[model samples]
Target: MQVIATAGHVDHGKSSLVTALTGMQPDRWEEERRRGLTIDLGFAWTTLPGGRTVAVVDVPGHERFVGNMLAGVGSVPAALVVVAADDGWSAQTAEHVAVLDALGVRDALLVVTKSDLADPAPVLADVRARLAETSLGDVPGVAASSRTGDGVPAVAAALEELLAGLPAPDTTAPVRLWVDRTFTIRGAGTVVTGTLAAGTVRTGDRLALAGRDVVVRGLQSLGQPVEAARATARVALNLRGVAVEDISRGDALLTPDAFRSTGELDVVLVHPAQRLPAELVVHVGSATVAARVRPLDDATVRLRLGGPLPLRVGDRLLLRDPGTRTVHGADVADVDPPELRRRGAARVRAADLTAGWDADADLARRQVVLRSEFVAMGWPVPSGATEVGRWLLAPGLADELAARVPAVVARYRQLRPLEPGPPTAVLRSALELPDAELVAGLVRPPLALRDGRVVATDSGLPEPVQRAVTGVLARLAVEPFAAPDTEALAAAGLGPRELAAAVRDGQLVRIADGVVLAPGVEDRARRALAAVPQPFTLSQARQAWGTSRRVAVPLAEWLDARGVTERLPDATRRLR
Candidate 1:
């Protein structure tokens, strides 16, 4: 599928030309229908003679609605840049091209609309000259009059040919569909419709909605329901249980764990769009987000984005000034995280950060990100931050450390019932690591430390309950294979939260109602039953072992069925 945005000056006949070619009006709202101008954003698509369809997004051309135009045009891989043949390039002409170039839309065709009203030569010549100054210098041009319908068909054919010649979009990349419109249906629940700019969406898929998750209940291709839609296709999604207000234009629906959010950004600072010395807005995907610019010494600065966008390395953002409304630059570097930071100059730069932590491997990467932001502000990247480098850790190790911390603390609580956790040094010794490196592996910016122990901010368990859970395990270890009654747990001097936490962590196994055993008791019972001569009966076994029937009956019966013992049809039992 191929998608294109129509970008141009206001009232330059962009909407009329779209209607002439598609036979479907781009305007949908009643006000727009009456106003006869493309207000907000209108969408339509067309099928060429070879039977290939191309989706067209009509962006608002007025100066005031430039932001709307930006949101509409931001994701399109190509564009139809409209200029008025009679009036030549309007105020927005330069701005539109600026945004397109900034967004890296090199594959575009210029449309000189309203051709019948005036002489075409002078206007076409001016557009030709303007095109030379843009990344669209080699872009094709076509003239059309919505009124006379003189060159509309030819324009369509030209667009289809251009689309046919372009390379296919990379669909295998992680999907990020920035929503431009969201609404609700009576039976369908919430429906979000948009052009999928960079990825694919399929039915029954779970998509992370910025901060939460929503399931894809259904989908539509053009107006027909379908299974999947890839990049450069218009899509409407029926999402199950997600409310309409949970998303809006510029919200990215992406795969969880695939996109990371950061307030900091790295960007290349150059353009055929404009000579930008002033700060500008950065629009990426469908989000009309803005970031202020200060030139870094090495052509990179940390950007504080307006929203939690799913950006990664090599992701391109369209830059424009919300105030002056011009596209400033094209293509930015992705430092490490996707975060928003200072608007102008910083004390740290990427160069300085690399200089400091390059040897420690773990600390080196973190210091680069932290110190870069600091240097951009022109502030000293603090010694405290540098000290943090001593504790900086690899992400995989940190994750492993995070996963083990709760259980570790739980074990600590067990071994020292009075002292919930031993010193960090003891923990290091237990894990067989030097105290310093272990602390470093479990401590750092992304990880946290409290009460002298490292904890994962993302790990949901709290400390007090973790201690209680530990206490339960300690008590259980002392009295293995014994059934601990509910009241007995209450009697163990364990809090309700601690008791619950113990169960949650599998510290004690609840075998039946009010019949809980120590963690490994069930396995021990099964093993012992396997060695028994016969399940003649619990009473018979008690007599043989000289122990109590209370200990033998359930254990023998459980083991008898576990293939540890065989029960005869007469209800007697023997080891298998």
Candidate 2:
């Protein structure tokens, strides 16, 4: 299915052309039909010449309802630009064409309406000449009179050809349906209507709406009930868990976790030479919001929205100066922009964005981004980006962080002489990294991870503490299993605090209560036990180590905990 929106001036036979093509009345309000003017949006669909169904969104052409017109055509991919033969291009005609051009709608059919009143050759030539300057350059034109039904067949054929030329919608893309109308049903529930731009919407699918969630109770396409619907089709969703009063026209139904809501954005102006005001009304999809603009350069500006919207990079927005009734377009460069609080920050940022929406530049600017967010923002992972677990980092970021780690560790050790290197969290904070997992990658040679902290290969201990610990280690080396008593340790000036510092320095290993041994005692014990018979009892192990029963019991348990030895049910042990 293909959707096309009507764009033209008031009473230029837009609704009349839609009615003639669809064979259905587009104007729903009686006042609009009575006044012969379209006040709001109207919808109608028809099967074209090739049996391809096309939905037409008839938008109001009056200057007063420009907001409503934007809402109707915001998501539609194609357009039917109507120009009356009797009245050549008017003010609204140029404005509507400017809107279509700003939105980058290229698939269009130029229709010269009311051909019976005057010869449409002059008007068709003039309209085509004006459209050639826009994005929809030199579109197919057909002069049709809805009153006499003359040339209607050719108009339908032109629309069919235009729809055929359009690229196929991506069904696998995330769903973002902009609601153009919301109403209530008596016995069923609340219903919302919109054009499903992409992705498949199925019954029972839960979607996000204005920070809340709602379930799709049912689905309909062109007034027919359907269990599932794909993109480029007009849809009406029966929603559960939300009241009709809670939802407005501009609200969007989104795939959960597929978007990020942001109040500030950086955009590259489509027309950089035009002078803009401080404030403008911004329109994207069906959403319209007031935004304050701060010029970063001639090409880029930052927009602070009145409320948060689910935006992404590469999205196009129409900016309208309400005071002057002028409209232009902008391309979103960054949705989650950095703050510009420092002096000259905005100028530097503008220089960064001056090259225009490059994915590699965006990755370099952010340094690190979650993989889900990078893809969710509608960009493929760039070629040079590095993938670290669930994150995508800028190219060569790991090497840069690794280069800064040794200096950080040296400063930390200098502050506290008796301790080892810094903790992972501290190192992460010092580097200003976003995740602690990144710190592990930054550890290079001469640095080892012990337990959960980073440490150097050699002890970073004080001179006095090193002297005391050396004496204890010399004695333990001769008598490997014979740990000194507390009185003996104190006499050597190695008290509890001093022993703890030695343990952190990797000079001593504290196994159990009143039992502190040399760093490699466990390896020595394993070597001694390996020579004994299989499944030796605790008594036999004590005699083999030539140590007291206290040291034997604790050492055996520590070996069991470290998987160095396995203890049997009968109080026997064997080397694992």
Candidate 3:
């Protein structure tokens, strides 16, 4: 599927051309049909000769409604720059062309509408010369008359050709549906319609809207129900958990946590007639909001938006002055930018943006940067770059962490030998690292992460705890199944803290509360039980081990828990 928006001056027959080609009315509102002008976005689609479906977004061509026009074509990959042969070129025509060029729209069809009124050859030549200087310089053109239906087939062929040459939409990219229309159906719930710019949205998928999650109750492509909708197609989503009044045009439905909405952006202005005005209307995606511009250099500026917008690096935007009616094209260099707090900071930032990421900077100073963002900014990761999940650490940061973390863990163990080594959270905080994974990555050989705590590979009980454990082990070795009481063990130096440390360090194993045994003591008991018959009673097991019932009961239960022995229904025991 492909979506193409119409651009031209008012009364230039953009809607007429779309209607004639699609055999469906482009205008939906009665007022637009009565006024014979498009006041908002209109939708139409048709099947090409190759049986490929193409959606047409008919936008208002009047300069007054250029905001609405921008909202329509902001995310559409292809466009039809409409120009009437009778009225050659106009101010709105130049404005629309400037927007398309600024947006970096390369796939387009330059159509000369109303060909029956005058010779299209002159108009085509002028339009071609104008486009030659813009981003759509190499785009093809077609002369068509929507009223008489002449050259309409040629227009369809041009659309098919334009789509064929364009690259396929990335269905795996994060979904960012810029809402152009929002309303509610009588039987259904809230419905938001927009061009699926990228990624695939399926029914029942949860989408982020205004910082809240909304499930896609249903999905439609070109007015027909569908299980899922892919990019470059017109999509209408029946949303749940949101009301029609809560959502409006310019609001977006996006993949959760995949994008960040920011009020400040660092951009590279392509062609500014002069220094931008203090305040301008910034248009990107399907949004138009007032912004304050701060010039960084000759071709770069920082725009502070009136509201937050979900944007990314490499997105193209247009800055139009409402007072002077001037437009400037801008390419986003950074979405989450640092604050310019000192004198000459803007100049420093401008240089940094141009030079790209600094390889020598500390990871703590650089913060977390996604690998995808680095690729979008055209900066490859420096050699030996450390990555945690999808984020890349600054160069040399990993080595620095590797050098310091083991020492930190050793110091922590020295202070609290009775407890496990510092937990993952504590390690992250101690190092001032952003994520726990970085701490985990730093834990190497002599240091290991276990049960959410970082501990030395050869971790053992302290001297006092080891002395206590040694006494307990000797006592248990004399009588394997006969465990000492807590009071007796404490008297022998194995107090509560030392006993816990011994267990944690693998010097001892606790079979039950207040009952401790040396490591592998259960195995020795299991071997003695195997010497008995296939099935034996409690008295027989007690006699075989030469221990009383008190020692045999707990040992039997512990062995049962370990699956070393199984108790039968008749009160008999056997090896499992």
Candidate 4:
């Protein structure tokens, strides 16, 4: 089945023409039938000459209901553009044509209604000429009067030809059903109706609505219950987990996590000659929201939406002045635009967008974005973007981040000279990276991770700490076995923290708490013990090194712990 919308001026017989072709009344409301005018959208369908079915979305032609008209035609691929033979063309007709043209709706059949009341040739010729100026250029024309059923068969034939020419709908795409009507059924809870433009909706399928998931309890198409409905077909869904009041017109039933809802978007004007207003109402699909426009350039503008919509690049939007009949078309260039915070950011951004909406350009601006989010926004992963697990890094972004690492590490070291380079967390923040894995990946030569902290392998201790270490090592050089006492160590500016830094720098060896010796002192002590007998007492070992018990006990214990010496049951130690 295929869906199409009807467009024309008021009293141009748009609804009447639909009825004549479908053999059913398009107007549903009692007031509309009584007043002989369409105030809201009406629906009707019929099978054409073959088994192919066509559904008609009959929109109001009156100027007051232009919003309604826009909603009806937003998702339809083709349109039945109606014009009365007697009226030729009217103000509403022109607006509707502009809307179709702005939306890039190309497949249409121009119908000249009320042929019995006036000559259809002039109106047909005039409507065709006007359509030539828009995207719907030179569509086929048919003169038909719903009153007398004149030329009705030719209208059906023309519609079949139009439907045959339309591109096939993508059934495997993500579902985004724009709700045009919502209400409660007698027994089925909340039921919402819409045109399924892409993907397929099956009964019991879970769909996203307003950030919550709702189950499809039942599904129907063309008043008949169905298990599933594919694209280009109108469907009504019985939903669970939501009340009727919660759902409204213009809300979408979506494939969960398949789309990104964004409030700020950048768009390029479809018709640059039509100047935009500072504020307007934006219509996309069946949704309408007020927006504030900031001009990026004469050809582009930024739209700040009152509410976020599930939007992406290449989506078509209709900008309407709420107080006037002016309507402008725009193509969304960026759904997640950067903030214009700098003095001339707007100008710079305008220049960047001049290349149009390319995936690489967006990736270049964002630097790094989650692959899931990039896909959700309907953006293809650009070639040459670096993939770091779940994230896609812009070209050269990793190198740029890596280049900043040394400076950040230097600043950190300058502030806290006694410590290693910096913690992984610090590097992550300085590089503005989202994950620690990225920080690890950016570590270059001479920069390495030591005990989860980033460090420069070739770096040395701070000058003050180095001076203290040099003083301690110099004293140890003369007295190889004499470890400095607490007071002497403090006098040389060797506190516990500084001593730890010296030990990490391989300048000092810490044997026990507060007992530190020069590097390779353990080997020196082992050789010194070789001069004694195979097994010696602690006092004898103390004599061998000519150091006091305070140095001998810890050093002997350190050797035993390292398996360099063995202790017997009698408390005598012997070098291994």
lDDT of 4 at 412: 92
Q: For model 2, state the Cα shift of residue 201 in Å.
A: 2.8
List the candidates' TM-scores in order: 0.63, 0.85, 0.85, 0.76
Q: How well is each residue in 224-338 modelled by candidate 4, as lDDT tens digits? A: 9999999989999999999999989889999999999999999988877436678999999999999998988887899999999998788899999877768888998888888
Q: Report the lDDT tens digits of candidate 2 across residue range 1-576.
A: 889999999979999889899998889899999998998989999988799999999999999999999999999999999999999899999999999988888889999999999999999999999999999998889999999999999999998889989899998888999999999899878999998888999999999999899999999999899999999999999999999999988899999989888899999988884478999999998899999999998889999999988888889999999999888788988888899999999999999888565788888888988989987776789988878778888888978988888888889889866667788998889989888877776788788777667788765567877887898889888888888888888887877777877887768999886689998887899989988899999988888898998788899999999999999999899999
Candidate 4 lDDT? 0.90
Candidate 2: regions farther than 4 A off: 338-348, 368-380, 389-392, 414-420, 457-482, 489-509, 517-547, 552-576
Q: What is the C-alpha RMSD of each candidate to the true structure, in Å?
A: 11.7, 4.0, 4.0, 7.2
Candidate 3 least-lDDT 10 residues:
356-365
Q: lDDT winner among the candidates? A: 4
**Candidate 1 clash total?**
28
User: How do all the candidates rank in terms of lDDT, highest first?
Assistant: 4, 2, 3, 1
Per-residue lDDT tens digits of candidate 3, residues 1-576? 999999998788998999888999999999999999999999999999989899999999988898899999998998899999999889999989988888888888999999999999999999989998998977688999998999999999988888888789999888889999998998898999999988999999998999999999999999899999888799999999999999999999988877778899888877744567889999887888999889988778898999998887777888888877777888777776788999999998887766652433323346556766654443446676788777787766777877888878878877887886999988888888777877766787888889899988887777776777787788778977677887888787877787777787887888777787778877788889889997999898888777777667887898898898999999899999
Candidate 3 deviant stretches above 4 angstroms = 272-274, 357-392, 417-420, 435-437, 459-476, 481-495, 511-515, 527-576
- What is the lDDT of every predicted structure here? 0.67, 0.89, 0.85, 0.90
**Candidate 1 lDDT tens digits, 1-576:** 788899888778888888888888898899888877667888888897768898899999878788788888777778888888878887778778877776667788878888888877778778878877777777778888999999888898889888987778777666778888989989888998888765688998898886888999999978999998887689999997578887788887877656766566666555433245445677777786656555454444556665556666456776666656555554444435323277532435545433432224323344333333333222333333332243333335455554665666667756644343446776576655433445554544534555565444444335665554566667657655555556765675554555544554456565444455567765665555555555566656555544445545665666655676677888787766
Question: Which structure is stronger by lDDT: 1 or 3?
Answer: 3
